[model samples]
Target: MDSVQFPLSTGTYSINGRKYRRTAYQMKVATDDVAQKFEQFEDTPDVYDDEPSAGCLAPPGLPALKKKIAKAKEVKEAKPESNSTEPTEDERISVIGGKKWIASISVPACFIGKLHGMNRRALNALENDTQCRVKTPRRDENKPCEISSIVSLECVQRCLDRIEIFVDDAKKTARVTHFVALPCDQHEVQENFEVFKQLVLDSEHFDASCKNPQLFTKSARLHLTLSVVCLFDDVDLQRITEAFKVIEGEIKEILNNKPMIADIQGIDMMNDDPSQVSVIYAKVSGEKIQEVANHLNRRLIELGFAKNEGGDEVKLHMTLMNARYVAQAEKLKKFTFDAKKILEDLKESYFGTFQLTEICLCPLNSNSSSEKFYDKLAIMRLA
Candidate 1:
């Protein structure tokens, strides 16, 4: 069967007299090899009543197809260089063990610098152990969720298992490892976040009377987590990188030479259910964002390099805070914070647009205090 893939732009698109909405740029893959193989059947639309779930393994011949494409690409590269000035902009995708590696991109520099500055402020705030909690917004006041969670046993187990690993080390610096994400700079919208944080430090927490709050998220460490691999090591990175190289063409195709100018505005709350610490994050929108996340995550799972984080789609957001440190603190391991109250005030407020440059394969929370949050193992840029 033949499959066609393409980028779905953000907008309301009409088909079969029906209108559908999509937010970010997303990858769409459909297979009708029987029809695509024959020119006479090309015009016919092949509808899938139930498409294969994201967790399913790739159909046979995928590896051979990858090798064929790589061979063809190699032949094309053999023709070699037009060293013209414009040609310099094209940097070949990095290869490891003779394979392309999976990588992530970066946000604009000015935005990242602002995030670092905010991180410094966040770090300074740590000096004062202020306790807080989330006040639930009246159900009517909040908007619908931008990102959805898949409630599969696999997902639940994966997240909980990872949490368990870190739960033991809450006192020391956490190396809560292995997650896929997109970087974004939100300082422009969060200019007064430091003050807002102060309010959180002094505010009353819902459901808890404790004066101590959970540890705050470092602004510099902000990212829209795509998938959590749960447990990963150097060997895992090696396996993941080669697996990514095999599908490099498809990844590029999904990107469709599109530049990453994303609208990462708004604040929102994400949580599993009614609990104490609601995850507060700046909202991210678009199909490209979701598709890229699904593509990378699904591919890795298929290769046995990683596992699914419940569902395929990623709800994009740069997480601002959670009580991650609460249970791990040596002295204040369990401080409560009213993340819901803070989110209620900023939830609909616009942040701004961000221009994404490259994608780097970052080791999750593996950086030292002196290092940048992204310890890139491999890097790639869009044309």
Candidate 2:
């Protein structure tokens, strides 16, 4: 009922336009006699791995050897040795960050293109200023700053396409995207991606260290950094002070409430320290205090600087330090509660009001070497 025939196998497969050897072995062993033959064949095959014959992709002749030599040459030519020196971290920033970042207040669509143009200008400047061998494409890819773009009709359409919802002043909504994929433009994603790339690069101070040398490092722990900033409008100092009263009321009420739990951190609400709260409450002044605060808070949210408890609008304040530096950096982490709950508790337990009008750019020096000094760049008053 069973009959079978085995044939000698020889074939070749092509991969990446090159041929590879293919050999097949087939036999049927039904009894002890055939089993012994199979065992003998295993011990000594008709074709050994070292043996070369016709149709084999690789052979022991000058032709095969020439092919191997050609391949070696190709690889050698493909990647030329570096005649140019690689730039240090600081140089990379200088090469990229030389352009000024212009942020638009009322116009949102002019954001990306303006950044791109500035980046191009920065690269051109770098090329003119340095002897470093810079490639045009590499320069094109450099995006040193984040700022408003010179808007075109097409850019406006794109911005409108990406907008999920609209918010009027004094309104809260939950449609915010948890995360946005950066450089959504596919045509120049890599080039435009650098708009945010340098901000996260390893600090220049510790790049020289062979081990544990970074002046700043990422941590798994999370904490809240808030900024209290004030911006004066079309008014004098008296009006600014009056505006501060409104902001002050909001701050005091939120602090007095002191929620039982921070919905975001899922931690004790009131047990956090007072100094941290103090840092968040410090007053700073500038014409654009509100604008700066809004920008900072928006950036923190965009970059996930802190887990939001999903309560109210994030208060405008400089995030002085993270939880990792809480032990040494002014010991401020103890003061920030579930600001949402804290404010709610304060509103219910005590009546506190705020009239905020100025923005302060303060230095947060965490004693840890792994954390670097950051500038609180701007401050604006909220209308």
Candidate 3:
């Protein structure tokens, strides 16, 4: 027997070594019959339902296909319900003062400084950018800032959002309570600092001009402040300590297991005027010292313990004299010293060099011991 051929493009099929083609009318009739049979099957809910028959086998994708169809039907049924209930953006906005909208946000008194810079310039900028009216609180007022707009609540919300970001940044950069420092109490540094203190105290010009001699910094309390932070309580202290502990290893690695040799020399007043000075400090300088100080300060900010304060470079100075020190001397009124003679005399004086063995976390309000250094709450060794 000859091999049978399959259906051809000409619409003819071969079977049992014979070929036959149906007319167009016959083809149409056959198609109609097949479609009608499928319609009947669909109408019989039991046979053509989403679930497969218990005795029939199911394909691997049959369950997934059924779930998809069920989900699509649910979505179609829910569309009208959602359309009927949901409000448009404009309707969702709460109306206040008829056409105008308003929002009040409470702010802390400490953050009032942050709002001060929102002056006429900043207000104009905000109005132009948001096309809204923002009434900033007064410097002394602890009240909330008011925002309003005739356009939309979203515009007022935008102004509020900008103010919040500005205040948040101010908080991060302004608050501080404790400080990190390297004590300047090594034997050689202390000896030199004492000599400089004595020179200022002994000068008749300095002595007569400054009646209060107790304004000098105690030798034991000499230190180079590295960074400052605002810690609220013991819990905050513990949190900061843990943060410090983690960064301690990085600081040590930065030092490369070597003690920092700090060069303390020369005398300079904190204020620009040399004649009327409230603070006198010995200049501290060195490459490694600055590198370590900057790294520690940057890490403190990254860890959120300290403020950024505009820069990472630590102003390394060992304060030798401050007028505030006179507060301990018999409830005296705060005084400034005439450092004109002192400046002329010791302008080129060298304090001395010493090895910084450790970095310490110290309280700002605590009294210094006989050793002259503030109480160290925590210490990280450099060598």
Cα lDDT tens digits, model 2, 1-383, are 78786644445679999996464454655557434443222222344456666673545587988989999999989986644433223322212132221221221222324322565674344333332222221223432222222322233233322221221211132223112110111223223223212322433422222112121222211122343222212222234345435544454343453321111111122324532222212122233333433444454444323235543354422122223333345544342312332223222221112223333232333243433223323333232
Q: What C-alpha lDDT does candidate 3 achieve relative to the native structure?
A: 0.73
- lDDT scores for all predictions? 0.51, 0.31, 0.73
Locate the minimum summed-lDDT window of 10 residues in model 2.
177-186
Off by over 4 Å in 3: 1-175, 327-334, 367-372
The most accurate candidate by TM-score is 3
Q: After superposition, how far is residue 79 of candidate 1 from its true place, in Å?
A: 52
Ranking by TM-score: 3, 1, 2
TM-score of every model versus the real structure? 0.46, 0.18, 0.54
Best-first order by lDDT: 3, 1, 2
**Model 3, span 1-383: residue lDDT tens:** 99998543435558899985432321122356336322231111222245554445677689899999999999988774322222224542345545676666655556554454455666677778998877767766646777667897778778778887876676566557688998888788778877887777776766464555587777888889889887644656787788778778888888787777888888889888776788988888875888889889898888777887758588888888888877656576767778888877788778777788888999888775655578888887787
Name the 10 consecutive residues with the lowest summed lDDT in model 1.
127-136
214-307 in candidate 1: lDDT tens per residue? 4556555656676665333344566666655665567678878776666766666666443455466677776586787778778766765455
Query: Using alpha carbons, what is the TM-score of model 2?
Result: 0.18
How many clashes show up in model 1? 31
C-alpha lDDT of residue 53 in model 1: 33
